[model samples]
Target: MHGEPADEGQYTVVAKNPVDKVQASAKVSVCTKSKVDKLADVAVNIGENARIQCQYSGIPISTIIWYKDGKLIPTNDQRFVITQETPTLSVLTINNTDMDDKGVYSVKLTNTTGDVEGKVNLTVKPIKPAITRDLDTSYTGTKGEDLILSIAGTDNPYPTCQWVKNNTELTPTTDPRIQFKENKKTNEYFLIIKNATQNHMEEYQAQLINVSGLIKSKKNKITIQKQPTFIKKLQTIRVNQTDTGKMECQIDALPQTRVYF
Candidate 1:
């Protein structure tokens, strides 16, 4: 049928068309997938190629159109093409989907006599990687604090994770006090700091990088908890004795540490 309504419907003046008044006030008969009003849930990752299909069941078959952001997105954009063979409508192919593609998509069904609409939301997210860490890294001899460094997010594209300290890369192979470990299967990465030093007290970063050279998460700074230390010196007025507040503390650690108790 042409874009215009033209002479499509069975309607006319003064009983000119037999079916005009019979079905004028009634909606088109929907028997199949047309009973429902919307598409199924769709989840896609950024930079991935995805397809969204809308469906409706009816005996008379329905004509469908798709819209993005409320406007008709012609089947031209490389990221968006249309396929009609499938009941409701088909999103041909969305190439290189990105953050911008995340939104609500609508499918409009139009028949000579009536029309109906439905919508679906598209969500794009980076893969979350497995993560592990040495929770505590506090001590009197070295840097006084608990530390952990690693990006906990991962994906199928094999995310590149790096620890940043004061905007600098934190490499485990070279740094003696730092240990960086990653388990790809679990998508877990860990940063272990042994006998931390004052230098480890600086800003810590965990960045998740992908093949597309896109950084999903920026320098996620890891929090560090440093224990408080107190020193006291006391002198007795007995004119003969000098005393120092003998304050001694012992620390014991588990899994990722040592004990001084």
Candidate 2:
């Protein structure tokens, strides 16, 4: 008698006695089973609003319940809202969806006859693409030697990278001695200076550009080493034999080079 139209009708019961018969009659009303509409899955970014809805049909609806991950959800929470569009439609709204909001959501409808339940999945996407750190650049280049200035950066979404020296962007040059290379695996950029000289010594920095905009890394103070040079030649002094004397010279050098007398 679950859902048979024929089962819906009038029924009568009669008791027969020796001389007279009495009968009782009543009408049977078949209550329709509660039917719940399926809910669709939702995918949204963090800090965005999300809505899940379902519809039910029955003779009389007792209550509508909403649950998240098998736990009953109360409307007291400010972030959650339960609303009824019509007698048969119910909606659950989540304000400012976050990572914690990602889960299975279910809605149930109960009536005097029966109850029905439906579920939907929610996915909240995370935000990324911001630069985290730019390691400090510090390198000492020996004069007339191949030198490298490496800049390391970290970011969620990969970005366009470049090197800047003396407030100017570095690019491919006709000079084969000078080269620029990028290490995609490590997210690092390298600037190689061949035959490094005083000219190549300058404040070097790394720059990153992406949809978020341009971001610059810490400056790298580059220093080039040079051989020592005498500012004034040693002075000659005529000394008697076996007399103790000292020879003095005025010199200038980078990195404080050791001087031999």
Candidate 3:
């Protein structure tokens, strides 16, 4: 028998002997393997529940299994809820969905005859950017020295970072001494100033922007000072008794320091 629904039925056989006649009858049952009919992709925002449905058709389904990213999902996981609303329909619900839950999900149905599988993709909606580690309130550097300011943040879609100084945007093209960089592994952004000078002293900020939203870090002040150096040594002058004496020296320093004798 082909084991199809139409092929199931009852059959009878009769045999006649020299003086007696006997008849026997038997009923046959058909079993069919499950087949996936529909599995639609799903999308949800973070902190929301993600539900995926799988529909199939079969005669006697023995078991159902779910997998994420080709790895079998453990039943002991409390975040996942699996329910069979009907013999042919199954649902998988993920509570408090996060970025980690976004991936390809698959469902497999098995029976004595055979098994069938279906897959669907899950996506987590992007959220507004947030600052995890902010820059220091102030940074001090010396003339001819290099300065770096960094900030770390988290976001669904990686955001672009812009450095602003005294309300003006800073870019490498405009100022060769300035450079912007990012560490994708740590989600940290950096603004570097090569050969820092007094001109680089100002209030700076970092702007993080993405499709979801934009965020700005706290303003950080950069202070640059030049080391003091003596341009000329003090000279001693000798005079006769009751005469006035003079001594002088020259020095260069930032902020103009006063000399005392």
Candidate 4:
């Protein structure tokens, strides 16, 4: 016999002969397979809690399970909390989410009739940018040589990097001698100065900014070293046997220089 909602009731079947009659009664039940009705993706910041909810429609739900990236979520894990507020609602909470917690989360609902599954994507955003590798406090380069300042770090959603020299921002378009470069995969940034000169010697810093926040590197000084050069040649003078004569010469150099006769 076909099963329907209206057929869910007690019934009796009788077999009667000329003088004898027999009857048996039974109850019928109607079952419906579960199906996911609503589910949504969730995004949360690092160190924050993430909540994923699933809404389903069905009858006689027998079991509910949660999974991450196709692996069953362990109930013993303290970071994961699973709850069913109602027969049709299921919730999963992840406490203190980090980069590893970001993945595809799914819910499986089972009933006497059939089982249904639903999934949601979890995204964990990183906090403020941090400098894993910092620039040196001081850098020295020879004049007319190439110099490169580099910094490495981690950041979410990527970040805009800027080079600051003596309080002035450095850009490729504004300064032809300077070039800025970044490697997204490595999370590294670079400031390149071609044919380094005395003008490039100054305090430098790197500023990183994104939606989360801004971070700046420590102040670094770039010194350009130059070889000593004679500004004035020695002068020759004639003097008598008892007469006194003087000879003088001028020299210029970076970091100052000592003169000897």
Among the numbered candidates, top TM-score falls to 3
Model 2, stretches more than 4 Å misplaced?
Answer: 1-30, 74-76, 131-261
**Model 1: per-residue Cα lDDT at residue 192:** 76
Better of 1 and 4 by lDDT: 4
**Model 2: residue 131 alpha-carbon error in angstroms:** 4.1
lDDT of 4 by residue, 4-69 (tens): 667788889999999999999998887778888888999999878999988887766647788999
- Greater TM-score among 1 and 4 belongs to 4
How accurate locally, in lDDT, is each candidate? 0.59, 0.77, 0.87, 0.87
| Runs of candidate 4 exceeding 4 Å displacement | 1-10, 15-18, 22-27, 32-43, 46-57, 60-123, 229-252, 255-261
**When superposed on Cα atoms, how far off is each prediction in RMSD?**
15.9, 10.8, 6.4, 7.3
Candidate 2 on 48-129: residue-level lDDT in tens?
8999888777765647899999999866789998898988888899998867899999877788876788889998875543
Residue 208 accuracy (lDDT) in model 1? 62
Q: How does each model score on TM-score?
A: 0.39, 0.47, 0.59, 0.58
Q: lDDT ranking from best to worst? A: 3, 4, 2, 1
Error of 3 at 257 (Å): 4.0
How many clashing pairs in candidate 3? 0
Q: Answer with 2 or 4, whichever has the higher TM-score.
A: 4
The true-versus-predicted C-alpha distance at residue 49 of model 4, in Å, is 11
Cα lDDT tens digits, model 3, 1-261, are: 356788788989999999999999998778887888889999997778999998888776647899999998768889999999998788999998878899999988898888888899999887888999998999998878899999999856778998999979998887899988899999999999999888888999999998789999999999887778888888767889998887778886665787776
